[model samples]
Structure formats: C-alpha cells, structure tokens
Target: MAKAMTIPDYHPYQQAHLNKPQLQFSDIAPLIEHYQVQPWLTVTELGRSVKQQPIYQLQLGQGDKRILAWSQMHGDESTATAALFDLLNYLQAPEQAAWREQLFAEITLYIIPMLNPDGAAKHSRVNAQGIDINRDALALQSPEGQLLMAAAKQIKPHFAFNLHDQNRFHAAGPYPNPATISLLAPAYNAEREINASRRAAMQLIAHVQPWLEQQIPQHIGRYADDWSARSFGDTFAAMGISTVLVESGAYRGDDNRQMARWLNFQLYVAWLAAIASDSYQQADVALYNAIPFNRSGGMKDVLLQGLTVSIGDTTATVDLAINLALTGDRRARIDELGDLSLFSAFHQFSVQGLAFKAGQAYPLNTALSLDTEAHLALLQQGYTHFSGDKALLQASSRLPVLLNPLRPTQGSPQLWQGATFLLVNTQGKVVQAVLNGQLISVPSGVIHNPLGT
Candidate 1:
C-alpha cells in the first residue's frame, strides 16, 4: 500500500514579488522571459490580440491527467493573472522541488496568463475589437476567443479553471462582510443539470471550501449556477470537462486586492493538490451546494437615520444612505434617502430627534478654492451649505459637505448645492450632522462617523 501524500503548507511558497492589484501584458514580459529558460517549463505563443500583442501559454508537469487554466479573460480583472504568476514562481523555486516532483508526476498543467492582452493593456473589459472574449466563446469572432478554443481542443484537458474578478458590492451570503472570494461549478446545460463533469467540479470546490472558510471566515461566496451557452465555463463543462469558476472580490480594508491575490494562490495550490492526489473524489458534493451564495445591495458606506427636514412649508423625517463612487477620485454621493430599513451600513448614525437644515446660500461671485480644511471649518461654523466650482468641491477631502450645483426645487433636492444636513436635537441644540455622506461630531457628544469628521 502507498502512503498518503501530505500537502505542503502554501504560506512559505507564496510569491511576494507581485503585490499590485492591476497588471498588464507588459508587466509580465520579463517574468515570461525568465520562465522560458527553465528546463521543466514549455513556453509557446498561443496567438496574438487585436492590437498585435502576443498571447503566450505556459505548460508544465508531465503527469497523465491534464488541467487547463486561464486568467484575465476580461482585461480589467487582473488579480487572477497576478496569482497565476505567483503560482509559477512557486513551482520554479528550488525549495519546492519535492512538492513540484509529486505534482508533475500526477498532472500536467497548461496556463494562459493573459488571454486578452489588448484589453489588459488599456485596462478595459473587452478586447480591442470591443467584444467580450468569454461571451464570444461559441461565436469565435474575436482572435482571443479563437485562440482559446484552439488551445482547448489541442490540450483536451480533464479539468479547466476560469479565473476573473468581480465588483466590490457583492457580499458573502447576506452577512455584513464582503465576498472576498467566490467559486462556481458552471452548469453544463440550460436545464442546469449536474452531470459527471459538473459533479467533479463541485467535489473539488467542496474540498477547498472548508479550508477557504477557515481562512476567510464568512467571506466565501459560492456563485450562483447559471448556464450560458456562450460562456467558456459552461461550454467546456458541456464538452465533458470539469470546469471551476473563481471570482476575486473585495475584502475589507484591502482595496488593492493584494489579500485576494494571496488567497487565489492558496486556492490554486489546494485545487491542484486535490486533483493530483485524487482527494477531491472523497469530498461530498453536497458541501459545495451548502456554501452560501453571494448577495448584493446589502450595505452602503455610510447611513444617517432619523432627522427632520423643512424646505419652506413642508417638513418630513428621513434616513439617508450614502455610498462612495469609484471614479479614481474622492467623491461620495447620496445613493438613497427616505426609509432605508432594508439596507445595512458600514457606518451608521442616529439622530432620532434632530432638526435638519441645508447649507446657506453663497454669492455667485465668491472665489472658490480647493482648501479642504477651510471648507470643513465653514461646516463647523453654522453654514451647512456652499455652492462653488465643481472642480474645487470634488478635490476637497476635508469638507463634510455634499455637492448639488443644480439647486433643484425644495421638494426635489436632487442636485441641490452644499446639501449638508444639520442635525439639531430637541431643546434647540445642534447635536450631530451629516455632510457629503459623512457624519460629524458636535460639542454635545460624538456621532458615529466612520470617515472621522
């Protein structure tokens, strides 16, 4: 009888060189050259993108079972590409010789690090032809799509890994935590039936779920099983190959997704080990089904609850939900107002008995500047609002004030300027306030403000 192969700890082998969240084809060119000289790896030009950028594939191991993995199908989603390179770095390290030998003896690996180099270079989601390669899998209209299909035909892999990144809004289950990582065994048919291929994929996911749960706690999300004939994952599964979809999502406090990259490397090693040792077969597919599905619209960046507002004759109490828009700039906007009881918040404030007032009017000729501290000082004084140049308002970070230059009607304050909500408690005392989706503290006591205003 043979002894069980012990899976090595992945922490020591984790590649620390690639830490950035964004990557491009040019960024990996040097690394590719470095790997070309290795004795155990075979580097080949799979094809070229619409922009004439070379798409390369790296092949390693000499095992009987074959596995195919690709990353950066969408150019903007570069985290998985970073992880694949990290994995390559680990595989070529002299210290991992024993583990590499065992893995190579049991399975052969084929990897396409950046399938859509054209889109990657421009930081776009689609190829240079403005077509999404994943959706073009069956059409084969795009060169990248055609190249991927050709590679799949030549490798005839037993298993496939489709890697990508998702938006930060997704939550793990319905919990407050963000979905740090998500996985899926794509459905093979429109009926969403589970065949041998999908079953195998599910079992592998099940085997990795426990370890991932231990690592991320309530941050693992099992992607919903949706069958799309044009998608590569479903199409490959329908072709009788076990396919797994891995989506890197946002983790708390790690905006660059560096932590997500490390987690991806860990997952790759675990999946490869399970396949090489046949340990995935022992895993229960039901466990995969049991993993929580990703949910959306659960929480916002900031929330203000219970305030009375008067615009001339009408007065009403409302709650406000504010969110930060990711436009490579510092600008927070009011996403919703009025009863937002269904939603959760990263930062919440209560002003149950406070009277709210909008910002005061500023002269049109007033000189505007990008002084954040000066703007915040104005808020600290009694003025709740100020209308000025859009550029200066958008550039200021110290100002806890909203921008609404349009100055909409009182009832419909859609784009009202300096839309700060001054919260005055009963007995005519100003207790707390909300500015530009952030809460501020008054002399009476501190309000629950996450932005530290």
Candidate 2:
C-alpha cells in the first residue's frame, strides 16, 4: 500500500569509496569538493574543528517539512559519513530526477556529513580537545557540538537523525550474530514518557524494519533508550524534534563496515522517500516496540570451551571468552571465562579434553621473518608467536610478532591477558592456536586476521 518502499539494491548503486574503518579529513575532502559545485545542492561553511579543519553543511530541497541529519560527531565513527556521500551520489544522478523532484516538493534536507574533522584525523571518538562532542550537548564545550546546537536552533527542523557506529560485538538478541544495524528513538526525560515527538521517531523506525528485515534477517536491533540528557538525540527529542539514532555496526568479514555502510545509505533513502510519500503515518508503533533490544557483552569474537588448565597445582576445566580491543590497531584479550554458557561467540572452538599452555616464542635472531606455511608449521610446534623488532617483522607472516616476548606464565590462561596461546591434545600435539584473537585450526592451518580485530 505504501508502494513497497523498495530501494535500488545497494551493491550496484554503491558509488562511494568507503571501505576504510579509519577515515580522515583528507579522505573526505574530495567528496565534499565534488558536492560543492553541484547545482542541485547548497554547501555552507558551518564551522571549524578544534584543529581548524572546515566543517561544512549540505542543504537541498525547499518544501515545508524540514529535516536535519548529521554524522561523525565521534570522529572514529565514519560509516554514516560514507553512507551520506553514497546517498548524495545516487541523489545527484539524473535517473532519479523524477523521484527527487517529488520528494523535494514535500520536504527539505540539511545534512552534515562530518562534524568532527580533527577527531576523524586522529581516529578518535573525542575531538582534538579530548572532549566527546556527543556528550557536549548540555555543556556546549566542543565547538563542533556548539555548531550543531546553533544549526538546530536556526533551522528548527521537524526531524533529526543522529548517525553513529556501534561496537561490532553488540548482538541483536541472545544470539551470537552481531546487530549490524541498530535504531533508537532516544528518550528525552528520566521517566521516558512517550510524547508525539518520540512517537513519530518510533513510527518511522517501525516503517523501515520490514525492509531492513528482508536485507539482513534477525540482525537488526533497537538501542537501549535510557535517557542521556547530554546527548544531542535526547536534547533534540526534548525540543520536540523527532530524532532517530542510526548505529551502523559490523558484519562477519566486514571489518571495515561496508555492509553496514550500504545498509545506512539505503535506509536513508527509504526514510526520506517514506517521509515524502506520507507513508510513515501508516507505520505500527507496536512493531518498533517489538524490535529486539541490543544486547551487549553477552557476545564475543571467539570462545574456547572446556579447556584444561593447570593452576595452583590443580587441574581445572574452564572456558574463555575473547574479544578484539577497540583502542589498539589490532589486539585481543580474554574478556571473561568460567561456565560462559549464556554467552555466544562469532568463533567458537571447543578445546574439550585439550590442555592449555603458555606458547613458546620463536627466537628473535633465528626467526626474524617467516612465511604463511612456515608460520603454520611453527604453530603446530607450539610456537604461537615470534619475538623481534616490529619493524623487522614483515606483514607477510600470519603469526603475531611481538616486540617484547611475554614472560612465562604458570601454564594457566590468564583473564584479560593477550589472547595468544596453544591448546594441545593429550599426546602433547598442538591442536589449536589462538593468535592475537583468532582461532586457527591446527589441522587445517586456516589463518585468520592475525591482529584478530
């Protein structure tokens, strides 16, 4: 009845070069430069970041229903920014003229693709001043946050979109699969009483869920709506603006979030089209409420089950939950252990009956370099890693090359330590190797991302 709400498939319509996780100002300058000259769009210098990088706003359309959307308030979150550029590229194409004209006749769009260039340059969540712009809504400390508030006051938009990237480890429900995309209609007050503004946001998210379900079934989630007074989404909702938060998370092999980026791009198109056609009024709020709440920490990247450990002169069976670190370039740590039956993992290796032990490090002088086959061979020999200067170790090796060799432990896996070790059979043959954070099957010798990030 709402004309199906089908958008062009993302893979073919994709035109943005957004396959990178750490996007900098330099990476996006070209896209902004290209859009500035487009006759159908209006570009304005909104403000500058703390490091003096220009932050621009892009505007289009002329009808009464005004909407404001922005991305990259946390510089490290750039999936939404890439999707914005991809959306712009598709909108500017002549083939979409008819749809664009019709949409423009009913609504106007104000978009900020990147709000924290300095933070982006450093691949950090905080701006150059080390202040989180998202949390600056009330304090108005960061200039980027100030610019956003000023723009909202000036525009008084009917709706707002707060775009972001959530942790890849967040799950849609009790399952191990990551919640690739999460939507939230942020609550305004402590009580979180639903008013017309919040209701509208909920209805819109409900309108998009069916289409999203078809794209990635059971992988969509609703963000926890605990009111955070300092966040723009919460404040905007308090101001009577319907604000929808779109969190682009990760997919299996999509370490760069390309899958999430494509979904974000297509989702935006669907949202604008639904607004233009008055289709959102038909959405059932119950569907939105039915969406699964995003579950966190209940899931991990890898899990080793029933491992035999020798600690305190006693042998005990345990389980370990491993997850890649977010701060470092690529490193994993043992997140937790014990029963862990309630938790789910992306990579689960049952080391039942296998004994866990500290892995031996190859001599730095003798093994300064190694090939994939040699790495696999060494893994079989209980050499989980190599010791050498990082610069001297080539990227060609799949095994982790530690600059400083780790001290020998008591042959017990320690919680919160780097996820690197070996699981050996009763015959003392290494059966599995957890390198960085990846589970490598010793028999198959299938190597995964060494950093496990």
Candidate 3:
C-alpha cells in the first residue's frame, strides 16, 4: 500500500487566507461564503456554543460510505481547522476532478470546521463555561459536546477523524526530533483490543506512513491508545466506527503550524483515496504499530547548560530549561532546572564559568532609547529590569518593563520562576541577558524581545 499510494502536493489546495496561527471563525468566514452557493455542498448549523456562537457543518458528496471529521474541538488547535477548509477547496478543483469524482462517488464527508467557536475566539482549550468539550463527551454538559454527539448519531459515519493539535514540546521517540504528526486507531475497550473497525483504521494509518515519512522523516509518532472512554475517537470506535485520530504535532521551525496543516491536507486526501479505493485493506498493521509513542516534555524553547546558580549560599552548576507559555499567561517560565541532560531546546547555550545573578531595576528618566549607547550602557551597569512612566515604557524595549514593583521571588531565578536575569562571567561582565525565555548576546548587541508583550 505504501508503494502504491500517491500523496497529493498541498501547495495548489492550500487556502492562502487561512494560513495563520490561532485562527478565529472571522478569519475563515469570507472563504466559506461561496459554499452556500455551491450546488454540490450543503452547509447547516449544528448548534450554538455556550456564548451563542453558531457551529456549522458542511456536507459534501452523496455516497453511502460516510466519513465524519471535525476540528477546533480544543479551540487553540486551529491547524486542522484551516486544513479542513483547504480540503473543501481541493474537492472543488477542476484539475483533480478525475480522482475527486471517484472519491465523491464512494465516500461522503460530514465536516464540522469549528466545533467550539467560543473557545476559538479566545484561543482557549475549553468553552466559555470553562469546560473542556472533548472531556465532556460522556457528560454531555457542554452544548458543543452535545452537538458533536448528535452529529455522530445522526450521520452514523462508517469512519470518524478526530482532529487535534498536540504540544510542540514532545519527542517522536527518545530521539531529539519533534513529533510532527501523531496517529491513533483509538481503542474501544479497556483492554485495548483491536477489533475489525480499529484494524481498518490502523491499516489506513499504515498506508499513509511511508508518505508521511517522505514529507516529515523521523517526525511521525503514535498517540497512546489508552481507551479513553470520554474521548470522541474512542467512543466512536466503540460505536463500530473506524475512528482515526490525527494529532497535528509540531514541526521544528514551523511556529505558525503551516507545515502541520499542509501534512493534514495531504493525509486527508491520500487516506480518503485509500478508503474510497479499498487500498487500505492491503496495508500491514505492523507499520502502524511500529510508530513511536509521543514523549512529552522532550523539548524546550531555551536551555542554559552548566550555569552556576546560587541557592541561598550554595552555588551549583546545573542546566535550566525554559518554555514560553502559549495561552492565558503567555510568559516564559523556568520549567526545569538542574541536570536537564536528557532534554533539548531550539536554542541552547553553554554558560561555562558564568554565574547567574538577579538584575537591578532602573527608573525611566525619559523615553526608552532602544539599542542605543544609553541602552547598552544600562545593561553593562546591571540594570536589566526597568520601572517608570507608562507613556515612556510604551515605546517598547528589549527588556521586560515592570508596571508594578518587583516581587521578592523576582530577585533570583528559581525553579518554575520567570526567565529574566543576567549571566555574568568571571570578570563580573554581563555577557548575556535572558528576558522572557529569549537568550540575548550582549557582545553582539542583538537583544530584541521575541515576545512583544
């Protein structure tokens, strides 16, 4: 099946407008306007979110072999949602009509582009009620969860695709490579027995394994099949649906997740073609089983190795791992500190013969002159933190500007503390400054804050 399958190039079908991070409903609203007029497609409101946001379902094709797929269940996971719109555009392309015609004639798709619009608005994981709709599958407490259940029973799809995005700080295996895509044939029972429906789903993933490797080598992984009773994929599998869980993980430099989005589009087309053509039956389940389980906390944003940190009067050389929080409180925290030899980061620095020190605060005398002689001088003088007039601070400096007075904990870099301090060398020279998890080179004078906040 690997040799026989052909992966579609995602460039032609890539929705240019939806190529962004944390995509809200407003971003894709204009592109979906034409679906209303398209004769082949049917768009209907599934239900409304807790905040009264309308949830939409797009029905494509008129075949008995049904496939149900949805995205943005956990709102921050917008990569698959964008790719779903791309899939819609791909189905309408005149150039691919030949294979697409067969696909449409064989399999019908009920796609819910955004399930939790209220959560999507705020780039949150849960709904407006602070409830995780995915976990609420059995409870049916969230309106979003109820709508999904209704859609499943109404469509009774032969196959279901549970689309989601996993954290970037995870490894494909023990290797340093990040898991770009995690596939799963969700287990229906507590024993995790592979039934006929699960067998087909496993084969489908196996059929696409080679193609995924061609695109993202050593980056493919398998999500743990823990038989999550409350999860939609597992529940659907228990209901005799061949449920496939495609978790869009992180690509090394693709911070916006466009790479993952493109891969999702390719997999959808290829897998659908396989299912439509019945090519997945020939695929070996061992290929799917061979995929490495995703290992969490495998990576961090920055790692400062061999740094001398002072705890009271005792100084010890250890490694510090820093990660930038993505959602609610978007601050860089010292996730782990002390002999983090097993972990890796996008940016790693060896601060040998250097001691960590808390930076002093300097009052703003005038407007913040950034990257100027005055700025460099201030850094040399050990003024890493700043507190001053609000208007002057609004100009934006590389350093973290303190609105309120500094806390006692802010003085020293502690475990799970904020990453804001100075790295001083033997001569007491401040050679580096870490602000908001970003490493700054003092000598090169390249100290710009990556997080604008």
* Model 1, CA-based lDDT: 0.77
lDDT of 2: 0.83
Model 2 residue 93 distance off true place after TM-score fit, in angstroms: 1.0
lDDT by residue (tens digit), candidate 3, 1-453: 332244346677788878677988888777667787788889888889998988889998777899999999999899999999888888888876786777789989999988988898998899999999888879989999999999999999999999999988888877777788989999999999988999999999998887787778888888888978888888899999999999898776678888888888888887788888898999999999888888888877778899998778888998988877755666677888788889877677888888887777778778765544555567678876677676666434544444433331255577777677788998889988876676777756575435532
Return the TM-score for each candidate structure: 0.85, 0.92, 0.92
Tens-place lDDT digits, model 2, residues 69-128: 999999999999888888887788787899888888988999988899998988889999
Which runs in model 1 stand beyond 4 Å of their true positions?
1-17, 307-317, 328-330, 348-351, 354-356, 360-373, 382-453
- lDDT of each residue in 1-453, candidate 1, tens digit only: 011123355556555555665788878888889888889999999889999999999999999989999999999898998889888877888877898999999999999998998898877899999999999979999999999999999999999999999887777887777788989999999899988888999998998887787778988888888789999998999999999999998876676787788888877887888899998999998889888998876666666777676677988788777665543444556677788776666666776777775545443344466355555555556555655555544345444444543331233334322234556666655555565555776643233554422
| Of 1 and 3, the candidate ranking higher by lDDT | 3
- Give the TM-score comparing model 1 with the true structure, all chains together: 0.85
lDDT of 3 at 385: 61
List pairs with backbone clashes in candidate 3. Answer: none
| lDDT score for residue 133 of model 1 | 93
Off by over 4 Å in 3: 1-9, 311-313, 365-370, 392-411, 447-453
